[model samples]
Target: MNRPGLVASKPKNWSIFQQKMRNFKPQMRPFHLVIVYGILFVVSLFITLYGFITYSMGFEFKKEYNAQNGQIEFNVELQHSISEPVFLYYGLTSFHTNHRRFLASRDEKQLAGKDISEDALKDCDPRISDGIGIHEKYPCGLVAEAIFNDTFSIYSNSSLIKPSTANIYPSYETKLFRCPNDDCSSQRVNVTDPHFINWMRPQPFANFRKLEGVFVDGMPQGVYTVKINENIQGGQQSYQPSLKGSKYFVLSTRQWMGKRSLFIPIFALCISVMCIIVSIFYMCVSRYDQHLKEDYLQRHSMKIVQSSDKRQY
Candidate 1:
């Protein structure tokens, strides 16, 4: 009899051979791991570069009054290397005697008594009782009008002098004179000059005095001197104010070599390198997984075939 789904009376050793392909196994190398490690190395390099170009803008005042510490002293680098000017709004802040001493050191006597009738001393010294006066004493208060030339040389030939310091740079503050008051309690004063650097135009200019109060616009255009009455610490030496009106050299911003902000392009480059490394790592890992899967399937298929042949025999 014939069966619907099977053949009856088949041959003694006949059977159907069904071949099944085992799972594909891939043998991929560990390229992905190498790529990931390479990316990490490059990112570290950028951080180091940013730390190494930045500087502040300001002059190092020889006579510096520290608001925080309540102390005053000379800082040579602050005076010569700084590019910014000293600005004052109001209040009694400390100042180093370097600028004041420059004028006082001109002669054996202070500048309080010099013969200077060139221009109006009214703007130079608000306390002047007679506007123009001379002194035969050791420290005479005086204010003279003068101009400065290039190379920071004092244009005026006045006898005004200052301490012999290596960082001596001509400044407008040298034109200070005696306070025009009769009491002479305040011995030192600065000459107010128009040609000098405008301290108030861009901002409030006066560091010690008041605006429209004294020496507003009464200083000489060049060299001058102002006397100092108070003795130095422990009676060291009384100094004066001496100034010249020539073009002074200022520090440039480019000269400030310090750590600066990072550039945008460099930062972007670092990010790009990281992404590429990650992608490569992923590809390597995927390839390795595929190789393992294929190997397993092939081994299973071989075992199944060998068992079937034995059963048939």
Candidate 2:
């Protein structure tokens, strides 16, 4: 009797997308394992050591300061004579400029010195309209409005430590940003300033530094005072003030790797360790196989000798 959902006999069948495969394990070879993995271990170990050594050689000094929007001062005592092309930077903590909404809050056309119309700045949101929503800002955006307006100057024994005048920012960027429509008819914001250019670009990290300026010849071993004219809210009279974030004064020499990171060296160390472990495993397997081959040959030779003696008898 034939069942409703069962068959008495089965038929051969195959699917077009179906595939079957079997992998065969080859005999372990000691020489290949040792040579290949030994080279990998050596190369990766070298990179791990080199990366850490170079990263630490760069000079860096940091000091935390009060979140003051007014004048502030700091006395920096150097431990040693820093190298040429030293940088001065200001950092902010707990301010995430990389948020999806925060990063996109800018009018590229408006910042290029073109007169962007008031109605076209939908991306700026609340920043699009002024405090009362009566008038619109020229380069209407949260990024432009929250520009870190702090200025810094270094002094050694009252002699001003002048920063390098060479433009650190791109020429096209610095040149392109000017007050759209005749200086925006205000004194509170200077769109032509390079600091404004730096602020417009969003940072990847929550806590990051923006370059204040650079000292091309570097500084001699001595104490220096820094004067800061702090203006966190852009010193705007009409604009709403933002939250006061912590500030840090950073003096760092250019590192071989542009930004400071430990991921590369750590990654190299991990890879090197893995290569050595794999090499050891294969090496042990090869040694065991060699022993088995030697033992079988010895037993066969003994059997042949025994048979020859029996034939003589």
Candidate 3:
């Protein structure tokens, strides 16, 4: 005979198991699951669309130049309007040449008044002086002076092209200097335009002001070539050097999309497709499982009815 305590504990365990099964019912219906998957798929699709729009909304033009007989030449085909001022930039992969004079001028202060002391002008002086009145001026020391020295001629196959005026304006800075008067000991003066202050800096670069006038809009579209030649004048009359082997030179209308611009759209599209595929697979599996459960329940109910009929008979 079993003990009273052991016999009573078996019924309590069975009751607990029945209660757990009742509480463990599926939290969501098939319709609700399908709705969730649909929402996720829609969100992924929106992400893909945004990326595509961002990738398609910019214009850029690029060309490469190779030196031929100590001269560089390339053709540029304009596809957009150059109604606004265009900027010219140059990038060098390796700069081993002696650009110390240019670097010094960039750091020099542009002070006002012609009667300033010689020591104050020495930093900005593009000329090499021996302090005994013997001085030699070099054009390669400053960006503005260097660009003027290297004359660039733009030519087009069409006769409608017109020449535009280009000018180089100096950048200025404000400084307070000690004055002779006691009432006002210091006075503010405008200094140089620091060449080091530029967005596309750390490389040898220069901007040809009013470059857009050279390539205006509504002009006949064709192949245009810019001929770059070094003018031998003053001290440069000895050895005339061209801008060959300068590594990189870019002529762009404005900032536009780069190669990495398409990466976002492509990546978003791939993720969207994956999300859609996963949702579809899960929906199919859920329907199949639902059908299997319904078939099993129907068979179980039929057996219960057959047993009751046998007992009644």
- The positional error of residue 50 in candidate 2, measured at the CA in angstroms, is 2.7
Candidate order (lDDT) = 2, 3, 1
Shift in Å, residue 179, candidate 1: 32
Q: Which candidate is the best by lDDT?
A: 2
Candidate 3 wrong stretches, greater than 4 Å = 1-37, 43-57, 67-71, 82-260
TM values, all candidates: 0.20, 0.73, 0.40
Each model's lDDT? 0.33, 0.77, 0.46
Question: Model 3 over residues 241-267: C-alpha lDDT tens digits?
Answer: 443333333454432333324665667
lDDT of 2 by residue, 215-275 (tens): 9888899999988876646444232235455678888887566655678889999999999
- What pairs collide in candidate 2? none
Query: What would the per-residue lDDT of candidate 1 be over residues 101-165, giving only the tens digit for each residue?
Result: 32332331123335544233333332233334453221222212111111111112445332222
Alpha carbon lDDT at 50, candidate 2: 86
Instruction: Single out the weakest 10-residue window by summed lDDT for candidate 3.
Output: 188-197
RMSD of each: 25.1, 9.0, 15.0
